[model samples]
Target chain A: NAGVTQTPKFRILKIGQSMTLQCTQDMNHNYMYWYRQDPGMGLKLIYYSVGAGITDKGEVPNGYNVSRSTTEDFPLRLELAAPSQTSVYFCASSYRAGGPDTQYFGPGTRLTVL
Target chain B: DQQVKQNSPSLSVQEGRISILNCDYTNSMFDYFLWYKKYPAEGPTFLISISSIKDKNEDGRFTVFLNKSAKHLSLHIVPSQPGDSAVYFCAATRVFDMRFGAGTRLTVKP
Candidate 1:
């Protein structure tokens, strides 16, 4: 299985611009998450979905939005980009809730907001 | 506030030596702890994990020790190899909420 896959390995966006980071998983995981890692900082959860049509905010959800329309896809949207949004974003999935042991991560997408 | 923290930013060890990475969490809600290894240009991969119930968990050359009282955990790699050089992240999770540490770069010199 491909496990988890994220699109746009690298991207640069101007201030006030918008873009979507696409994520897909072939593992049919019930839980999916979006996290961003800044330089010298740990991964901060932007959003998470326990299943399709159920999304919730996380530690750093400002300027970010997410939609889980299908079991395989969980996309993150940035309405208005800002310099503070520059970071490496990662998508991950797990077979079930509370089972991080089965978590699989995507390569990551590096975003630069200028 | 940073819930999970890896105090050491980097660590260097000679090949075949033992490399230990430490992590501490400020939240007591974290029951499951994990260690992930990340190579350059790649995503982090699961290395090992320990639950709060068990004090330790071992998998091959990797071992995880958890101290619930101190809200601390550690990963020990024995006989480290050059290929083992990478950034190690400590993660703690409760149910669906997971937090990661800043990461500690481990360099295994040959």
Candidate 2:
């Protein structure tokens, strides 16, 4: 069902540049999240949305922004990329939260900022 | 401060042996725990999960055991196969927030 899909599997950006990582889930999930994973580090949440038009910042939200314009899509924006922002980004979705439901993840997007 | 941790960075075992991966969490409020397996160039996938109320859950060759008092959980793979080799991540959830461990790389040699 293409549980979750992300565009531009790999990208390279210069400092101060901006770009959006596209994420879409066809599972009709109500919860969506964006997370980044650095080498030898656990996945850190950057942002998440409860539903369409609702979003909230997470642990590592300083350099990233997210918008949930629709239930199926949640996109992350890097306004001014920095070297520290370089990491593998993942998008995940679940039918709902606060239960035993599992989050389905999409193939990660590798980003490198110079 | 890392709330969840996988002390072992990597583990190796023969293809036919039992492989055990351990995880520990400092937060007692975490009510749910999960295990995910990830391969290179791919996102992590759900392997197994256990609710704090239960001490053990089994699915095929995979089994997850939880010890609330110790705040520790483990995943066991029996008769490991080469296909089981990958990075394993342990995750804990409290309400809406979920935290993951750094991950333990497992290699099953044939």
Candidate 3:
């Protein structure tokens, strides 16, 4: 089974442009997350959802938005992309919270904003 | 402010040697800690983890140690192999949030 799948493995956008990064999981997980990794930095949380229809902002959610319309998909939206938004984006999911549930991550999407 | 920190930016070790990576956190409320390894062009993969109540947990060749009083944790890889080369991330869980520290690059040379 495809654990977690992300589309458009790489994308380049111009300033002020908008795009969506798609992520889906077949694990039937209840928790989903979006993170961005900058060079030499840890992955920073952009947004997360506990389940479908519920979402919350994470540490670095300024330029991003997310929606969990269904349990299997959580897509990240970038509106008016900025240079600061150029980074490797990762989508992860877990069955539940706390202790070794193992958040399965997708291959990642590399986005560049000029 | 960064709640979690991985001080070493990079480390190199000969194959078959022991490789130790350290992580420190400023928050004492973290109940769970984890180590994830990431290959180039790939997302971080879960390696090992430990809980506040346990000082140590081992899985295969990887071991994670937690020192609650010091707010410190470590991942030790015994008989490190060339395949272990990657960027390693340390993460901590607090309530409903999870925080990740700057990663450490580990290279095992043959």
Candidate 4:
């Protein structure tokens, strides 16, 4: 299983430009999440989905949007990139809810908003 | 407000010594705690985890101790090796909401 996979390992975006970060998992996980980690900062949740066609905002979802079109895909959308959006974005998935079940993370996408 | 925090930004330890990383959380709702290890260009990987009912969990050379009363948890790596040198993140979750600490960079010097 590939676990979780994120596309475009790295990218540079100008202010106001929009892009989508793609994520897909073959584990058939019921939960998927998008988190951004700034230098020296912990991962902040931007969005999460419990299943197909269901999405929810997280703590840092202000400039982000997410759509879960299939059980294996959850993509994050940046409507208009900002300098603050520059960070390492990770896509993670978990088999089930609750503690003890570890979340598998993808390699991460490093984005720079210039 | 940061619900989960790793006070120490970095820690240095002699090779073959013990390295302990600490984490604290303010939310009592967190029922599960986890530790993740990450290298320079890679995503974080799950190292270990502990449930609320258990006070401690051990996985090979790594052990996790949880203090529910203090809302604190710790990860101890015995006989630390250079391979263990990386950023360690402490994470907590309640059902679906998983929160992470700022992370502690552990340097195991040879």
Query: Of the candidates shown, which would achieve the greatest TM-score relative to the real structure?
Result: 2
Give the higher-lDDT candidate: 1 or 2.
2
Q: List the residue pairs that clash in candidate 2.
A: none
**What is the iRMS for every candidate structure?**
1.3, 1.1, 1.2, 0.8
Which regions of candidate 1 fall more than 4 Å away from where they truly are?
none
DockQ of every model listed?
0.74, 0.75, 0.73, 0.86
Per-candidate local distance difference test? 0.92, 0.94, 0.92, 0.93
**lDDT per residue (tens digit) for residues A18-42 in model 4:** 9999999999898999999999899
lDDT of 3 by residue, B1-110 (tens): 89999999999999999999999999888889989999987888898888889999999999999988898999999989999999999999865588899999999999
- What's the DockQ of model 4? 0.86
Candidate 1 lDDT by residue in tens digits, A1-114: 788999999999999999999999998788899999999998888999999999999899999989988999999999999999999999998887664474789999999999
Look at candidate 3 and give me any clashing residue pairs: none
Interface RMSD of 4: 0.8
Model 2 complex DockQ against the native: 0.75
Best by DockQ: 4
Better of 2 and 4 by DockQ: 4
C-alpha lDDT (0 to 100) for residue A15 of candidate 3: 98
Clashing pairs in 1: none
lDDT for each residue of candidate 3 in A14-88, tens digit (9 for 90 to 100): 999999999999999999999999887888889999999999998999988898999999999998999999999
All candidates' TM-scores?
A: 0.98, 0.98, 0.97, 0.97
Worst 10 residues of 4 chain A by lDDT: A94-103
- Angstrom error of the Cα, residue B13, model 4: value is 0.8
